[model samples]
Target: MDNNCLFCRIVAGEIPATVVHETDTTLAFRDIDPKAPVHVLVIPKEHHADVVTLAQNDPAGSADLLAACAVVAETEGLLMEGFRLLFNTGAYAGQEVFHVHAHVLGGEPLGPMLAPR
Candidate 1:
């Protein structure tokens, strides 16, 4: 775990978050800043700086992260209307929070907007 990461703190119970889905491997919580009617951040319990870092640390976990998107969709009731999953890899990619997270966003038409720039 990264000693100074915000998500690590949240996972370790040092900080509070509105959690929706949680298991031994991951945790899904409401994003503090929501871009949609239903915006959730699906994060790994284990700490890694970003998706690149996560891939290097545990490639299997990286794949698991993607697979976890299904759970997020089912839980959030976005399976029918469709949902978008996004990962902001680096600073230039708009990854403000260094911790690796998947944005499971949906609940509206959202149009043709890209997930993240």
Candidate 2:
């Protein structure tokens, strides 16, 4: 775990978060800043700078993350209904947080492109 990372702190229980789901490989929590009504972040226990690094360094972790994302979506009532999953890889992609996390967003129809931050 990255000691300086916020998501790592959340995974370690060193920080408090409104957790919606958790498993052996991942943790799902409400986003502090929500874009949608049901915005949540699903992160792996393992520390990864970003999705690219994760996919390169650990294929198992990548698979686990994808599975966890599916689980998070299902648990949040977004599966089958409709939901948007996002993983910002770098600064250009709006990755403010370095930790690898899949953003699960739903509860409303997302019709257009999201504004760049």
Candidate 3:
């Protein structure tokens, strides 16, 4: 775990988060700044800068994250209406935290994936 990483701190129990689900390899927590009715962040316990890094470095952990996201979506009652699982890679994508995380969003109409430009 990167000592300076925010998500790593959360995984390390140095920070507090409203955790919804946890497995041996992953964790699902509620987002402090909720963009939707159901906004949870699912992350691997292991540290990786971003999804690309995670996938390249730890394939099993990447699968664990996806499994955790599915469980979070189901637990949050987003299965029927569907949901979005997003990974904001870098600054251009507005990834404030460097650690890889999957944002599970649903519980209402989320409109489009992006604004019309």
Candidate 4:
């Protein structure tokens, strides 16, 4: 785990977080800033700058991350209602935290993928 990474800290129990689900390899927690009624952040316990890095460096962990997201969706009762999974990779993508994580959003109509263009 990267000492400076926020998610790593959360996983390590160094930082406080509203953890909703956890497994041997993954951690799912409520987002501090919620975009929807259900906004959970799923992440691997291990450190990875982004999803691409996680996929390239630890494929199994990457898969675990995805699995964790699914578990969170089902547990949160958003599976049948539908939910959106998002990964912000870099600065332009609004990835404020460098640690790789997936945002599971649901609980209401999310509208378009982006604002009117």
User: Model 1: C-alpha RMSD to truth?
Assistant: 2.3
Q: Each prediction's Cα lDDT score?
A: 0.89, 0.89, 0.95, 0.93
lDDT of 3 by residue, 47-104 (tens): 8999999999999999999999999999899999999999999999999999999999
* Backbone clash count, each prediction separately: 0, 0, 0, 0
Q: In candidate 3, residue 61 scores what lDDT? A: 92
Residue pairs that clash (backbone atoms under 3 angstroms), model 4? none
| Prediction 4 TM-score vs. true | 0.96
Task: For candidate 2, report its TM-score.
Answer: 0.92
- Per-residue CA lDDT of model 4 for 35-97, tens digit only, reads 999999999888889999999999999889999999999999998879999999999999999
After the best TM-score superposition of candidate 1, give how far the Cα of residue 91 lies from its true spot, in angstroms: 1.3
> Which candidate order results from sorting by lDDT in descending order?
3, 4, 2, 1
Could you report the Cα RMSD, in angstroms, for every candidate shown?
Answer: 2.3, 2.2, 0.7, 0.9
Model 3: how far residue 83 lies from native, Å: 0.6
Per-prediction TM-score to the true structure, in the order listed:
0.90, 0.92, 0.97, 0.96
Error of 3 at 37 (Å): 0.5
Q: Is candidate 1 or candidate 3 better by lDDT?
A: 3
Ten-residue stretch with the least lDDT total in model 1: 108-117
Tens-place lDDT per residue, model 1, 1-117, is 776999999999999999998877888999998999889998888988898898998998887887777888898899999988889988888999898999999999877765677
> Between which residue pairs do clashes occur in model 2?
none
Among the numbered candidates, top lDDT falls to: 3
